[model samples]
Target: MSSRDPSLSPTLRLRARGALANETGRFETERREAFDDGWDLPEEERLLRTEVRIERPRSALTYNRSPDLPFDRSVNPYRGCEHGCIYCFARPSHAYLNLSPGLDFETRLIARPGIAAVLERELRARSYRAAPIALGTNTDPYQPIEATHRLMREILEVLAAFRHPVAITTKGTLIERDLDLLAPMAAEGLLRVGLSVTTLDPNLSRRLEPRAPSPARRLQTIRRLAEAGVPVRAMIAPVIPGLTDSELDRLLAATAGAGAVAASWIVLRLPREVAPLLRAWAEEHYPDRAAKMLARIREIHGGRDYDPAFGKRMRGEGIWADLIARRFRLAAARHGLDRAQPPLRSDLFRPPPRPGDQLSLL
Candidate 1:
């Protein structure tokens, strides 16, 4: 591979290939770094390559008791998203595996190939009670690799066979490939989808999210899903206070025009290692306004980098947050996006028969 010019800014470095540096994960007991050893080589030659490791998790469902979340359980088909959004709140999760929440979080991905089998096994348990299982809550299931792995599609097949309800959130246009499954399940009120559109500016979206689909593509995905009879919601998440917050009305308007039936927003959050990561990104990309941007974030975060407190964390707490909320509400109302779709039904759930089990007498 050709070497990238070392003189490029950090934001440009990320835009070049997803992350600025391969910092060691926080849980790692050892660390390493590179230095000039007198053999001058181009930086592009040293560009990090993405490596995916297959993980066979014993369980598929991750249950949570967090009061602020709308769902109680979620399924992550992959760990370490390739979408590589610099401000991803899920980045810190890499620490558990002794991986850096920076570059390593994006480049060194983990795929659970057996997720569908495990999900089926769990769903068939005698004690299992069906509820809407959430997908793409931590990482995008439709990330680039899914095209080859096809785990998400298999999981959907199991859900469809069992007639279980599901909810998904994603920015990947790849989800459209599964409309044959999603459309029919949605017709039964067993599925809903939310597409996150962070910003409408193509250049800004490229720099911030790096590998995720462009704003235009996401809007198209929403339109496609809505046309297929799937309930679609447009999510303007991590609404950066001074950065992308100004685009809220326009983003909502565009998605609504594309056929979204509901909308929501979450203020930008910088938790754990993500705080410094975002700070570095801002200084590199928007030096003049970096301080002002962070100051506004602090103002909403109650003078801290973040507040993990329930309910308040997602929406934040302060005048600026309140203002954003009011603006979103008004825009949604104006676009007739205030109506809520009914809850997905769990009553239709039925466990598929185990292999080699006796055939039902009926």
Candidate 2:
């Protein structure tokens, strides 16, 4: 039996033509001659190898003009996620760097070294306006490398120094390291956080989001953040229709019980190459229900893999969509989790002191 561990980040380079098929996860080996003309590679080189490498990016902040998103500007401290969720929409982004979106997306990573300084300069610019700068909107900021790189911590330092209001979304337990910063900012209403917990089942969560913090740990994060006076919202994102959708109400109740003050959810989305990649993964893991899951996703997407319409992109249209929405509302209402989280205050923002600036003696 093939090992089904999801937490391990394995590198898989393409070995041979026709070795990869949609229906199976196992690879079969065959012998080949060195003189095969159509074979671009020699038989000796057919044995594939994977090497881990790190990429450094020049600049850090990414600006977005999409009307659908709440924040106009955001920053990503890392590129290519270590948490290999098969349904991740961001996977296709790897194609821009001339890499396959499958295994490459999980193994290949980019780290920004000077992001914190760049952010400080941008935030302190003369014309820079103060609005909440979101973190972890693309790739998770607190992924495994965060412990050593400390880019997220530096970014938070800049935000804290300038009194800039900021929001964060993450699933890594590493975020707990920054509570000292977040707790105080949250005290002044300058920060808020959302924890995206997909499912409570450890087995399912293991396969769904390989490198993310365990479900129990996420619940603990909610409890700790709430205890620290930081407004915490539990986000049940990318709800797979026939798979994890069943855990909706239970997830909400559990998170609320753990002290999450607000709740939100997004239906499963199969945009771009994610559609085919997810289908391949489903066939490998749950062959029996793969077809049914795809069908349910299409039913909500109007017979298509995805619909990128502004309002309907996040939440699809149809009876299933309506049902999920209603279920979320009822569950949140029952849990007394409907209180509106106050917006982070922007009026408190003050530019940081210039270089070599002295502490005020007054």
Candidate 3:
């Protein structure tokens, strides 16, 4: 059987593609159906191919007032993430486009090629105030498709030209390709990167985040970025309760060994449609632990699958949450990864020259 064939595994037999099912979006007024003939198809024929659609949005920057987040402004060059992570909190966002939060969220992606120009215009606005704009905040800017479209690179060039500060969070090793630009930005204290490392076990990583870089590759990425003078932080994001949480110390130590100067973590969050997807994934891949894992999750969230309240969202609320936090603190401190890094400098920002503007006569 082909590697992508879900029928090969008992847990994956339910999913023809990456997700368990192609659920209809909440806003979709219409529904569709598919029928499989008796004839068996080849693995290649059954494989789901990704489709990229171009989008020209009027604005590129997304502003949010959530207290749980560190930054107020973010840029998402892509609409949907190709990394088919089962626990992705951003899955619900696909509903806005009348697409399924399941398989469609990974296969049907939207690329904004004109985002760089829009960002430039916004940055050049007279009322604009300079601040560190976050990248990979909504969807990864360095997903697999980014290598072909290069929209993220174009956005980086715009930020580089204007000397705008940027903070990037991603799981793709593709960021290593832009060291030439990022290294210089790092020298000026305008760039910081966070590499999210979910688990150390290759099998678990593959089952949870199918398309993301391997744990080893991510560690190498952290090393390369740190060597390039870029501030690197290891993000142990969406720490699953009974599944991957036990490896917290090992993950932190590994990251620190890879030259990550700081660390952070967020407890697993299952908001909206993500809850059902994760529960299904857990039941399929880890049937033995599914009940216990889900019970622990609810325990942390106070009898609910998730608590959307800002303060309790990122780091749940309960004894289990406190235990995880305490463990992370000890591990981080042991590795000397508790040092606070300086914030990205926005003072170097300079508006890009507009069309028809006079050249400076220096």
Candidate 4:
């Protein structure tokens, strides 16, 4: 990567990151940008290193009543996913922490080491009701940093001990490492996993997701999980228009052949700060088709970059959106993956016993 290169060229220097700029977030007191001081002195090109801060927890589960979502509760073990997918809808969340949704959203991470304990306590509450808690909703729970932090593992342990149900969505192959814990829960219908496979093309995957696992690797993960008796859903998430739209049928066939029991799709969404970042990335990477690709997105979102309406958010309305949906449905049906993954069972939930607790003489 050359320092003299254009400011928006991330690959020319920053390597695998997806953001085109390191602009400050919206909540910052002031905006800051670098400028040449006219000194021709040599300077080292500092590569952005991932910085992780420990977040002590006050609460573990975040509850929402969004009609658009399937689950009402979720727990994000980490903030600012390192996967660095340029089109991540979660990018704007970094701004609430006074961090940039650009590079900062990928390089600067927050790990919650104490969330498991907090979650255990919360689940033990008298008012608590059993429901499948979602993971990797905002940020991938099994992101690269999870390898060392192991917070996800700890949380899984708590859930397993309590026989609690969990639904996980991720593109990380590291999930294979937790088979020991997951296999048993899977036997009891307490878990399901959604593996996002954006595109079947490896080169396009690297440019779009950067640090995320290759598309083939995600399919392999789905196979492994399915073989383990765990329910697996192949998610063709944020399906980029013009770029990946043509590959939808191939994706369904591949994932179905790889043992994906169900398939789902979400159109590319560029909400908040994610819009400009994706536009810049497109300009830097796919200069020729960038405009056409963006135009397709506009057609899906009613002539705008995005439409956040509840029913319209996940799958936009329009001819283009309908075409993609129709294609997915037809392909999925042909591949025997027309149905959605079944919800995990919550009836088996039982809180773990605490010291000094009364013994049940069942």
Candidate 5:
């Protein structure tokens, strides 16, 4: 009798997840494989389940020296995303935690409890300098689990109390729930939002980002945020050369119609495990165009699946990259999104008074 591991073969029924396999991380010394013992296990067992662990953060701000990044510091309240986008470049980061960058990256998550308190202490430090602290830089801060954890709201409360500047990027519609905090911060020039709209077609979005919000839903989110007076920038990230690249102009038009004030785009990036993961996903989902799609992706990346070079990693290199850049510039200009999002104000920052501090009456 022949046997197979059910989870090894994902099906359309898994509407809540992505990733074709739970491949072992590169750092793992011993590999693991599932075995069918012929006991006829129930099919419901095949469904993947998400698990969350709490971490007490010793530090709130993670500073990066990456030359290409717009911000130097970011705060990630959660690690391991629930929205399992098959092509996520952040997947490989899970390997650092001794976890697989595949299915495990989405199934296993970490929530930082009491992180807002830690952040408040850090901001209150006399040596601490004020800058726009970015959220959702490494992992989405507003993932579904956040609705229960309420960490994002607590952090925002701290920032609001201190009058600190912040910039957040996300695809989660749950951000709308915090308009009470966001609207006033934006009015003071202390906030901006990046709503990632990878594709306008819901079908492609379903396969590409199974657990993330739909393309239409994201457009509505942009409109909602804009109506609240918050600056919303449409982010057209990872334009898949053969798949969603053609939608660039249409995407800008749609976002503009939804009231976005600015726009940006980045070509597909397949670093580390992402290269193979996306290849397998493409073959499974788009067998007819997988080869051509991958070929063009490599062409843009200087004949490699990915080039980690700081200057070239995000936007890529060569003729195709130039062409995409030109198209984005033209589309952005036509849509009145040629400008960058307004810079957040740091001058408004004032640390909240701590307990036991001397009070003065004037």
Candidate 6:
């Protein structure tokens, strides 16, 4: 892979944030930089030109006891998303690897090259119990890099072998590549997918999520999955208050038209490092409405950029949130998208046979 060159435009200047820190985790402003051009940079420095690094986790199942989450166990095949969605809540996770959550969160990626084998071993362990394993709950598993890594596919093969149920959420059109695995799994009620479409405007989408699939492409992905008999739910996530909230009904209508069976939405969240990154993004892209957007978000968050309190974190707490919620509620109801689809079957899961064990003769 060719190395990405730093921008050389005379008008270009770096925007620094507290999220930038070296491997030592020491906060130094010099380590941070960003281009305020607000337009696409040259291909050599587009930020998506990142080389993936591989890391192995001792275990793959990240057990979540949070009552707010729907699944108990989830797996992330990679860290730091290539999609470069400026509002990603997963950005802060980069700090754990001694990396910056700013540019590094997009450019510096870590993949678990052998995660599928590890997952298979864990699933075959006697103590293992299967529930619906959620993919893309944190960093997107189907991010652009998955084209070569194919970790999600390997993991899916393991899930299919053990009759394990799974739920996936992603914004990548790349998920379409796995339809063969997902279609059969969906037939058995063992799989369901949630495609998150934050906005329908291609221009807004490009600024908000530089490398993710175009909104229209995502709509096509949903249609394809639906046609393949895969259960699909449209996720209108992080509904940016003063920005995308106005499009709530239209986005829902369009997605529903494209074949989404059910729908859900979450208010914008700016937790940890994400708050500063989003503030920077707002300053860069939506300068005119940036103040209004941040203010509205703060209003919903009780004068904070974000509130991580269980249900409040997902939806937020004030009139703005309520209004958005109401609009989404009415829209979903009117469109008949308010209905909850059935959950994937957990009872179908059977622990994989352990090594050195006799094959079942039943």
TM-score per candidate, chains pooled? 0.94, 0.85, 0.92, 0.96, 0.94, 0.88
Ranking by TM-score: 4, 5, 1, 3, 6, 2
Q: How well does candidate 2 match the true structure in TM-score terms?
A: 0.85
> Which regions of candidate 3 are displaced past 4 Å?
1-18, 35-45, 354-356, 359-362
TM-score of 6: 0.88
lDDT tens readout by residue for model 2, 1-362: 22222322223333311112222112324322223357555333233333334545545557788887878788888777777777777776766666556665665667787888888777766898888889988788887878888989999998999999999998888888898999999999999998999999987777778677789999998998888888889999988999988888899999999889998888888877678778766776778898999999999988899998888878899999999888888888898776788877999999867879886877
CA-lDDT, candidates in order: 0.88, 0.78, 0.89, 0.90, 0.89, 0.83
Q: Candidate 1 — which pairs collide?
A: 3-44, 4-44, 25-99, 25-100
In the range 1-362, model 4's lDDT, one tens digit per residue, is 22222443332257699887877788899977566668967776666788999989999999999999999999999999999999999999999999999988999999999999999999999999999999999999999999999999999999999999999999999999999999999899999888999999999999999999998888888889989898888889988999998998899999988898898999999999998888888888888898999999989999999999998888988899999999989999999989866668899999977899898999
lDDT of 5 at 241: 94
List model 5 lDDT by residue over 249-306, tens digit each.
Answer: 9999999999999998888989899888888788888888999999999999999999
Worst 10 residues of 1 by lDDT: 1-10
100 in model 1: Cα distance from truth in Å?
A: 0.5
Candidate 4 residue pairs that clash: 1-12, 1-13
Clashes of each: 4, 0, 0, 2, 0, 0
Lowest lDDT block of 10, candidate 4:
1-10
In terms of TM-score, the best-performing candidate is: 4
Give the TM-score (vs. native) of candidate 4: 0.96
In model 2, which regions exceed 4 Å deviation? 1-59, 356-362
Ranking of predictions according to lDDT: 4, 5, 3, 1, 6, 2
Q: Clashing pairs in model 5?
A: none
Candidate 5 error regions (>4 Å): 1-13, 38-45, 360-362
Candidates 1 and 2 compared by TM-score, better number: 1
Model 1 C-alpha RMSD to native: 3.3
Candidate 6 regions with alpha-carbon error over 4 angstroms? 1-48, 351-357
Q: On residues 94-184, what C-alpha lDDT tens digit does candidate 1 reach at each position?
A: 9898888888788889999989999999999889999999999998999998998999999999999999999999999999999999999
